[model samples]
Target: MKLKTTYLGKVYSFSNLKELFAKANEEKSGDRLAGIAAETVQERIAAKEVLSTLTLEDIRNNPIIPPEEDEVSRMIENSINERIYSSIKNWSIAELREYILSDNTKSEDLKRISRGLTSEMIAAVAKIMSNIDLVYAANKIEVITTCNITIGQKGTLSSRLQPNHPTDDVEGILMSIKEGLSYGVGDAVIGINPVDDSVENVKRLLHATHDFIREWKIPTQNCVLAHVTTQMKAIRQGAPADLIFQSIAGTEKANRSFGITAELLFEANELVRKEGTGTGPHRLYFETGQGSELSAEAHYNVDQMTLEARNYGFARCYDPFIVNTVVGFIGPEYLYNNKQIIRAGLEDHFMGKMHLLPMGVDICYTNHAKADQNDIEDLSVLLTAAGVNFVIAAPMGDDCMLNYQTLSYHDVATLRQTLQKQTAPEFNRWLLEMDIITEDGILTNKAGDLTIFNR
Candidate 1:
């Protein structure tokens, strides 16, 4: 395949797919930090130009990290429907991008074609797409998964009630969950990012949140964002949990850095199905970000965006109830600023939808990053318009434990009302029953009062 192109009468060439993929990415500090980003704007465009002409087969044949070397690549390769792949193997990335955006292309059509795609192919198309293109195309695909309730239906927006505490204080965490529920959030899950990952601490949070959900009769799931092994141990010791949470990466080595393997995930899946809480199937929750692989020194010279796509490829194998990219939480060293964060948020949502994962975005940033609440709010709106499955919500948009800012309980309520969207159907019914929201899904006068749950 040709890896050279000319733009503005300047010749630009990339040595291989790995280099070309890195250069084709939108400006990201992670790639630049790795010294793999294009040296000039024209060179980046030239890489995109060359990338656009590559065939699906070309990308498949030139695996960024060969299947023989990476289990993630092998899993992604083995997951493709060879029959479907053979039919569209000759299509160029540009044609693939246009087809996704074509008025004639419906959601079902995209779903059918998605079975043929490899993660690399998906990333290639995303690199050539504009921000609006990412939103419009992603809006066409709806991926629904059910753990305690169904999510990702059109006209529906969900929020994960992230009730994190600075010291794993059960009371503090419960206060946040009560506040979030009072605002009609938590349809996705009442997840906690524990300051401690010990099995005992994880079990404590799980049991506390489980008891709260049971007492309120809330139609939502509960999870503690602990390591897979920790959660597995907690569950084995008889802790109640609605879902198991883990952070995943695009490459095997990065996953190892997190102390997870595909086999471990499979074991956790089995344990959750047999010994844990929640309804039939769809019980895994995965969190990912753009720079995780590079942070672990496992990117294998591939661009962060492509590696992000591969995360979906790995995530799909478990049929996770939700998969969200913590877009800006990786810091300025990777995403840089709000513009890049917004672009990555859109890219990840689009790519996950294309991979048919129940995709969401944690529209968040660290304190030191060159962003503020306004930028996060703007991306939240953009993601909402793109039909995202869910977003993480903290009290007042501040996660005291993680020390990052994300969507607040109030922000979620406002987004739903302003966008004319509803929560998951089951949770929506619960909200009305509790007088938290009106029949039309607007927050009722009684909403935002934690005292209501006191009864």
Candidate 2:
């Protein structure tokens, strides 16, 4: 396929699909650090112009990392429905983008087309889309999945109660959970990032959250964000886990750095399916982010956005109950500032949803990034408007364990009220029964009072 274009009388050329993908991306520190970003604005535009013309078959034929070289690439390739692929293989990326945004293309139509796409094709389309283009297109698709409760239904915005403590103290964790539940958070899941990832500590946290959900008869899932192997061991020992948790990456090599393989994930999926406590189907939780591959030195010169899409491709194989991108957590070396972080958050959420994965976003930032609570707040609103499945809520937007700032319990409550969104159906019912919210989903006077749980 042609890879040359002229912008303002200057010809720009990209040597390969990998280079075209990188140069076509919006500015990202990760791509710049990898020494593959476009050298000028004109060059960037030229790259997008060329990328928009390449057919889906061209992208599929020129794999970023060939299937023979990587299991992730292989899995993504193998997952495509040959019949669906053949129907649309001739469409250019621009045609694909317009089709997704067209008034006639309904959500189910996008779902049918997605079965034919590879991660590379998804990334290619996203690169040519503007920020609002990404938003508007993604809003059309709603991916619903179930663990203990259903999420991603229209008019719903869920929150994961991240009751992370610095020391993994059971009481401290429980106290946070109670506080979050009081504010009507945790509809998505009560997930914790443990300071200690040992099997015993993981199991302890799992049992703590599980018991609390049981005692209150809360309609939600519980999980501990530890290594998959550690979580697997805990589950084997009879830890009460409703969903299994792991952080996944785009490349097999980066996944190896996280101590996971496709085979291992398959085994985890089977284990949770047979031994876990969640309801029918869909029981895995995966966290992915841009720059993970480069952090592990396994990016192979691909842009972070494309690699992020590959993360979804691999994740879809197991039909995860929930998958979120911890958007701004990796620091400024990758995302640089609020603008980059915001762009990446929207891109990731849209890509994940386009893959038909029930996607959430950890709208977060580190101390060093040129972002703050306001930036996170801005992104949270944007993603919510885009019909995001869920967002992570820490105690007042600060995580003592992970040492990052994200959306807070108060923020989630405010978002639902301001945007007229409700929690998952079952979780909304629980909130009404607890007197935390009214039948209209507004917070009642009893809301935000932790002592309500004590009574």
Candidate 3:
């Protein structure tokens, strides 16, 4: 019936808090002991600390994490896009879409309104706007849909290496490679989703991944997929902000939960661009999903897919290099099941293409859903045919920290070659150099050893 208490690296054990306090009382340290216990209980109460059990051995095995630092720095806060977000945040979704439809709506109003909308409203605006006007807005914003930072031409599909880990563990990263799959060494950018926002850990992943790139000489870039605000701070602090990453939604409030406003997103994108983080107008990489609006409680009674489309409208305002819809990754609550997941993926891709955005689709399903790899493959085949701009290449279509199965490494390679598709421009060149793929796009024996970090 003994329990262990760990505070600031030291461990104390007792049958109950009273016994621990008695020991502290003997040393006149009861105040400190009581404070630590209260704080621990308060922090973990929602996760249910009452039934929790920890042995001294367990405490020894698990290291205590430090307190989370301020997520966004002062410099980052000062750098958010100067465009006033209040203009749109105050408006309802219906009012915003109506404003988009009215010719009298000022360009600034539309710009501001774009930030506050969700997918249904985004799709609503797109559906009502004339093709010419959509084109006009794209040009007005200087949006760039197609980019060749690494190696392929326009219409060339790319794949992102999504090797995520809880602590940015180096071995976990290399495991993806040892599976005869070069994660960060692949065709597109190597973007790792750092599980926490710790600045040092973020930098460690960035530096290590860059080292891997150097060791392999892979024609790809690296990104620690943190929030835009966090990435901005990392960039300012000298982390490799190779790609500015964000998960945008139609509403300003929803975006804010991820530590960003629309203007903030714009500023983050602009900051990375000015810092030379990415080239060829492909600085920003975004991930979107259906049901985000509802998840945010900002759906405002609109359908999830439509709101998802609206997010593209909002996202396109930044003119991102890559916009990916993480279909079904949100789970069964919003998308419901396999059919809804598949439908939403195609809808998001089509919506992005319609918005003149470079679209990528993550045809994924989670363990909590009534779906499987067959659903992902089905969506993958459809997205490929839909000419998706990029797709995620994780192991078994699943990421450990992400806790969801996405497209696998083999799926990406086989799909690209079988579809006779090309990779990002410079990446295609690297594949050619490695002789992993032939001039006509056939996989060679060299492709098998792509798993090697260094040739």
Candidate 4:
């Protein structure tokens, strides 16, 4: 194989870009010179004859040749292609929201005629909506598509829906395996608490998610956060920053995991940007499940940490879904006194401290513990009056569904439908009228051109 390398700021076979430019200059000017320079640059580079030392200063001072528009287009297209492919290889289904919806025309142009579109349309819409650049393209009417939304079983998180968490059984695991094998699941993860020393169990779950993604060709979120955060805290708490960095750098997997998580989160932020076509139904939420509730101090720390998370973006720290029975009080005496309990649980960190993620009464409906139906209804009404987004309703014993009256699935579906009809930059003002989301929902369009308006 011939040795290949770049020299000075350019690549060279015989040693210089100057000679190549000289030969090209003998015959062309204007677009033709541009065309030759554009075409010749690659050959020169490939032949190892590029002048690597060339810098912006070189261009500003010597101005050998202005880069051709075609060259620029080619480079931009290459970069985009690389990004799209890399994203597909590394990201999970949850992560795909921004990428799939990026090319709007791929999604929106079909919406007008799409009676019952296929999974491809759904995936395309999701990808277009999530990718900011693609969405920007759509706003320019160069692309047309809305964000995609499909709800399949989401691994352990979904299993939390079934009674006894039965999804953990061999049969359930096998079913998950089969679905993953068949494409019924997107990214099916099987996470067990590391505290449980269930390494084998964790591996099985990871493989299940991985296999499902491979078989179904759906993207997957790395469920490593729950495990890694806990482990990282233990390992890196007191280690010097340099040491931590070195340790992380020493392994590609270690370094990449953090990067992957950060990228996914950043993508999520971009997808839910304030200027998007439609607003998300749930503005804020608190994730307090296992490690979330430890000591009361631990709970407080989690609350503080979540507030910190919110500072990074739009999440807030708040109580888990609230329920009346959990308070263990009754009647007006119980009701009057328990208000303080619920209030303390929800408002402990809200005054200039951290944003709280309460269940907006419209969103959650729950009956945790109440002897009478009226008692439950009273609490539900109180939650609604308080303007909480998620509420705990125990309509089904033992299996309480996270209910939402204000932000229904139907409402989300409608908002999505509206957004599908509208492209980026185009205002879909009618979304405000839908009342499923907020009036400000479509306000983002004011900033651009392709935006659709109610009129």
Candidate 5:
């Protein structure tokens, strides 16, 4: 077989050290030809060693991403609340201990034993206390939309106030857009509050959202736009939505807002198609508001509903209020609730259109699976089999899986290197089966590592 060899001793075959060394050792050495082969292996091996060292340094120096202010505050507050709750549950015992320790006549030995607070333990507690302060101080809570208020007289004797009209709070509107772009998503989900029982308020929100998209540089194609209840009615009554967002809020109204939005989208698609003057049918979108109190049942229902919509060929956007990674084990009831929903969504049949974007972490994949191992492994493999394309990002999750466009030779090499370092057998197996790698393990393409490969 003809192979490209470089002065860098790039071996064109084999997956890693184990395979490469095995192949080389199987052949005899010492002749000129053997020397060339050995040199090739040695150079590649040297490259591997260099790469491994760099990876170690990279891992060590990898900065812990500063959690978003609101996210961190919520996490800390929730943690502290859980601690307080637990303490309250044992208040009787704690009160008894306090009483015992407060005795003035207690011996020095008894006092020492009862009131012992180790420097290390005190330091740990101090760290946690400090974090709580830092989190709250750094976090800011801001409303996402503007409103119009009517000041009413508290008493008949009081002076009458003029009826106030709904107006846009441009700053607040911009904040949500900015925050969404900065922390939520590159492709954001915009929600306009249209439930104030005022048509003007609905229109203002609509126009504001539309203007936000243009001013904030939020790409039209990348956004999933939604409007609340009154806005839907306004649109139904012949309000212009060309510059406004597609409907979403009305879906939760007493009259079935989702159905209304869906109907309008379909009608809008037909109108444009018939006119042949407007953009085509695919421009329409559906945004669904999902609320769950970090419970397994609630999560399952969210996922189930998303999956159901997907099955019906509808692409639904979900905004989950509570998720597991955020709350962790502290809120077991809520934790189980939200996780169940996520699990069901992932396992859904038509999960492609079911957007499972949690604000907490980004999920990205580098390659398609050439083979499957376990349930999760098979699901990942199936995504590849179904031709799901991954958008490249730095890294996500506890295990930093490099997100790539698709399973390719270069991706294989990168994934292989990562798996090798992490000693993750599942990752290695998936890479092998994806055909992103050669049977022997060499990258099928001329690419090297992720940093270079992405560049």
Candidate 6:
């Protein structure tokens, strides 16, 4: 079977990469050839080319193309990793911050620290970063957090409001965007979830997204919210990196269960920074829900809220540009029902904003859950007053991939017009530039956009 592979993130045929690997000697396996061989091996796994039941014996008899996880490469990687850990293991969080902030330190040094540090270590440093130090070190490492906000715009928090299309149809996406955008929603990037795991599918979705962005000049960035590792692999396979995306959780082990790692997260952050892909500070965007801790079996008997707060700290380490707490997502087991779900959303928002992060609330509930549009609407209005960052604009209040009901486009307009709230600053400027909204913040275009839905 043919497969997609990448060399320096440019996609190529797997057969070609394997041929190159066969010609190369063991001495040339690791940290050479522009990191092509390593990434290609990774891509095949992400593409599901490797059989789950395959073992070393199976590999020996029927070799997988471009051998994976070879000992030579692991040894070299491990040795370097050992050195990075040895240097920082004894350092305190203050010292770690100092090390990051020191003028003598190079960005390459910080990148290495980012790669080698464990999630727990990141959490430790995340908790202690003085607010001033947080901003300073973020600037130093180029880990920006403001994706779409105008800081002094009359206390307006930003939102993402994903109108996720089940089929990944460009038209369906545009249909959803037509409603959400005209409503002054989704100022915070319009990230989508792909129906399939194929990297090609992600590229197709992103390509359509770009066309839509150009057609309307949406004044927003974008990301495909596939698995973190999958998204990273896609980025390596030459997908757009507008915003490196993932779903995060509160506990470290729970995060690992989602296949998220500090290493993968740090790598994606650096890739976007180097790629110069967006108009904002933060590069990564994450969607987290209340019950991931118990879902991963990593809770260790902690309450969902506390573990969820710990998640904010975990997200802070990588300096995500945005994190949306999808409260009430997992159903009765974690959040119990609407009452607990609403409270969870509030608590998560308060904790995230207290950390000075760009936090969004999805204000959603699932089909099997005990909430509905009113529940989401109630939570949405309350969070709006609480100054939470953003909310989803999924069509019909259900994200096809996430299988949960969320805020609709009409819901967003209802909140904004009723409360006289506005979207994040930069987007508001674009709306004014486009005349979609009146100078006084009226959505004069909404009635017009609704005509498309009726058609």
Cα RMSDs, all models: 0.8, 0.8, 18.0, 24.7, 27.8, 17.4
Tens-digit per-residue lDDT, 333-363, candidate 2: 9999999999999999999999999999999
TM-score of 2: 0.99
Per lDDT, what order, best first? 2, 1, 6, 3, 5, 4
Steric overlap count per candidate: 0, 0, 19, 67, 17, 9
Residue range 153-176, candidate 6, lDDT tens digits? 335645565767667777887777
lDDT of 5: 0.26
- Each candidate's lDDT (Cα)? 0.93, 0.93, 0.59, 0.25, 0.26, 0.59
- Expressed as tens digits, the lDDT of each residue in 1-455 for candidate 5 is 11123335453443332222222221111111223223454654443333222221121122111124222112212222233234332222223223223434232322232122211111111112222221221111110110110111111000000111123354544443343222112221243332254776555655555565545443322211234344445556544443223422211221132334334544554442343111222333332222221121222111112212221122222222111111121122221233322232232221221122111111222133211122223232332222222111111121112122212222322332433321122222333453333544444432222222121
How accurate locally is residue 127 in candidate 1, as Cα lDDT from 0 to 100?
Answer: 98
What ranges in model 1 sit over 4 Å off?
A: none
Model 3: per-residue Cα lDDT at residue 219: 63
In candidate 1, how many Å is residue 102 off?
0.8
Worst 10 residues of 4 by lDDT: 239-248
lDDT of 3 by residue, 259-286 (tens): 6776687788778877734555677888
TM-score of each: 0.99, 0.99, 0.67, 0.25, 0.29, 0.65
Candidate with more favorable, higher lDDT: 4 or 5: 5
Per-residue lDDT over 1-455 for candidate 4, one digit per residue giving the tens place of the 0 to 100 score? 12235545565443233333322121112213223222464543343222222222222223121224222112212322233333243343233333323454343333222222111222222222212332232222111111111111111111111111223343444343332212111111222222232444434444444453345333222122133333233223321110000001111122243342333333433333332212223211122211111112212211221112122111221111111112222122221233322332222111111122221221222333223333334433333223222222211222212221112222222222333321111112222332222433332322222112122
- Per-residue lDDT of model 1, residues 1-455, tens digit only: 99997799878888999999999999999999999998988988999999999999999988899999999999999999999999999999999999999999999999999999999999999999999999899999988889888998999999999988888889988888888998988999999988888999999999999998999889999999999999999999999999999999999999999999999999999999999898947999999999999999998888899999999999998899999999999899999998999999999999999999999999999998888999999999999999999998998898888889999999999999999999999999999899888898888877678788776
